[model samples]
Target: MSENQYAISEYHDADEINARLKELVGQPLHPIRRDKMEEYLRYFDTKCSRSKAMTDEAKTIIPGGVQHNLAFNYPFPLAVRKVEGAYMWDEDDNKYIDFLQAGGPTVLGSNYPPVRDKVLELVRECGPVTGLFHEFELKLAQKVQEHMPGIEMFRMLGSGTESVMAAIRAARTFTGKKKVIKVGGAYHGWSDQMVYGLHIPGTRTFEAKGIPGSASRHTQEFYPNDLGQLHRRLIANRLRGGTAAVIVEPLGPESGTRPVPFDFNQQVRELCDRFGALLIFDEVVTGFRVGMGGAQGYFGVTPDLTIFGKCITGGYPMAGGVGGRKEVMQRFAPGIGGTGERAYIGGTLSANPMSCAAGYYAIEEMERTNAAILAGRAGDRLTRGLKEIIERLGLPFVAYNQGSIVHLETGAVMLLDVRNPVKLLKELKPRKHMMEEMGAAYMSQGVVTLAGSRIYTSMADTDEIIDEALNRFETVLSSVEGIA
Candidate 1:
């Protein structure tokens, strides 16, 4: 760990998160309490009428009445009116202590003022995109390299999905290998190549529908925190052809919904070196939110390529990127790529002055206030308070966090084996439904979370805001206490 107090959030300085997660993983958490779920569903339908109306209206035009699956909460999604700092108001004017943090990008909080102002200024100044270079893009890349010394070069992209695709292409092109291995249950993105073995590790493709089996033939899975498995896989792959890259969410999928050991990254780094595989850190969720340098910096293990998502600006139009050693990053260049042939990657709206300004100002604000540490502190407060609530209510639900990213796993149903068609169809239905219900339960009580399983705190979440969130959380706990 660094004696420098600033970058301390990078390291696993606090074991409480790991300890709590270990206990939760072992504990037998049941399906969401049936009565509790029914009760919450009723409450949601009754109290969230405005949201229901909006969703109904949306479904008329949009499939499922929601654009993103993340919006598909139980009963319906809560439509937001506005958000600022640590709170958000719904269309019904109900207030919530914002914990979703826009799925881990808005460490400064939604519509953060300074960044927003800068983005507006840039939009007015340059009209979003001119297919030309902008100074802010250089500044943003410089800022990333400044904090993460591992990144000798960087490229901004459209979204985390785009970034993942670029990184995968770069890795394969740079190494002249085809095989890609990622941790089981980790979600790199929705890109076709990365759609293999998502949500649960070691499973057959669930989200790979319509994507040909051959599409994922070279892609494989390794269990998280299991270096032995990775070593074995790399050696196995070497027999046929060298593994191009080993990509992973440094803290585990969904920002440590399944937390990893403190030394996991170091072990992976060593193993990647021994196996001649490029280590790619998928920092889309962990990037700047974990610390200034990200999980690679936190663990003191730099990967050959790093995938950045939502690091540029939270909830903005354009987000995500790839930062890595100059050699690997050069593969995306127009002229002689790292592979001696251009590894194709580009975007019309990518690295526009608007997104760059938002990212540049966002980082500036976060650094000025040490937003990562403060957000992590808020996460600690929220997690601890949730633990106390769970204990008091005697609920079997689990709670743990990594820096600002929090996980409240109600069951391990998502990890169920998908290879068995019968089991897959039978188990996933109720589990998915109830999970959304649990999210709705929290939403009903003025707390908007990420699918009711995760919480992303922001620097704006003070003790008071967290306490307010906790009070709402207690209501959720009480509603679900029937199971206990």
Candidate 2:
């Protein structure tokens, strides 16, 4: 495949990025200046009073005043009232450049008119769901297959969590093996078994509260980019009823915050083949965003099963599915005949006409406009500008991109691993708080980012938009302590 076909212009060296991340975490916290943070917080108080009032009232009914995890912004989440290409307006009408992109689904940008219009037409014609067959379901699946031929068949589900659950169940049923291995710190969604290693590697079950120990009994994890550790675990699992599947986020954990080497996926594929295990690529964040073919296409490696997440519908609801070779995918066939033979999974609104139409049209538009490559160019510009700002201000920060999925590591909170349990435990809270403050600072300057660290650029992010965002980032980064 040509380089232009995928979002990643080049693959980053995992070792080099890890070394920089280590240096960042080793240093004392370089938080936003206290005065600057107070000022930014005041922006939330004065400028966002309406948002405060609404979220405060919501807190009485909703836990943490927000429903989704991404909505948990520091100093309380902003109530978004409007979202368009590359920008969103909070309830208070405060305009900001959108880098979050609805948590990496809106590659064509938020509320993209083409996709929205198509969805509206579908909803008007047939309604959202009939709890029955929809033609668009076949159309959407065919569209996905057109781009990703490895997915000989597709099964739609309600959410990424549900899709992952179905995938694991299918793996176990197909292979008749109990154990499944995953890369540590990679989120395959909030499914019980996959929740063993949440944010930090080696911290098994640390965040798996309220769940029974048996839930993750067969789940295992190796450190990110650590193939030797994974090999040993696979070897160990062989003695214990053999391995079922090896799942990974092809772009590495947290969408390349902990990046993998160029050949990582191919190596993992080889290991899976050698161990008689199925390879599952969790392309929830990477699927269409990386390219129409996904990370597997970008890396020139194919997996037995591929998981598609929110982007399947171009940020539309009911956007999750599992696709793979015909033999394995047939395991998800809906019927009543095979009790133990089939991997049963169902969602009432899984392949709603609205979602199917939206996904099909959105993907068609993506291919028509070459959105992924355009978005990647924007990411390259943004990362380059952020790096220049960091260097000029003499700050201990890191900036890089895997195409449109850009990562700016100002706090390095996610970099902390269980390798040094004492350091991780001691620094976790402070580092986390620092990230929260940084996010708030950026928001105050009219930039919305993911945890103040990761930024997802879209095709709507033109040169002018990117340059303006860089100015906002420069203002936020320059306010860090010791920056002249």
Instruction: Identify the leading candidate in terms of lDDT.
Output: 2
TM match of model 2 to true structure? 0.99
Q: Write the per-residue lDDT of candidate 1 for residues 1-484, one digit (tens) a residue.
A: 4524232344343345545554544554455456766776786666678988988999999999888868777777778889998888888777887887777789888888888887888788779888888998899899999989999999999998999889889888888888999988888888777888788666648779989889888888887667788888999999878899999888876577667777888888888888888999998887888888888877789999998878676568799889999988888886333345567988889888788888889899988988888888888888889989888887767776776887777744554554555756676676676577778878767788888788889889889989988998887677653543
TM-score of each: 0.92, 0.99
The true-versus-predicted C-alpha distance at residue 137 of model 2, in Å, is 0.7
How many clashes show up per model? 4, 0
Q: Model 1, which residues run further than 4 Å from truth?
A: 3-39, 335-340, 415-426, 481-484
Candidate 1: C-alpha lDDT: 0.79
> Residues 1-484, candidate 2, lDDT per residue (tens digit)?
6798998888777889889988998899999889889998989989998899999999999999999898899999999999999999999999999999999999999999988988988898899999888999999999999999999999888888898899889998899998999888888888889888888899899999988989999999999989999999999999999999999999899898898888899999999999999999999999999999999888889899999987899999988999998988888888657675798898778888888888899999999999999999999999999989999999889999999999999889889989999999899999999999999999999999998899999999999999999999988888899987
Q: Report lDDT per candidate.
A: 0.79, 0.91
Off by over 4 Å in 2: none
Clashing pairs in 2: none
- Lowest lDDT sum, 10 consecutive residues, model 1, at 5-14
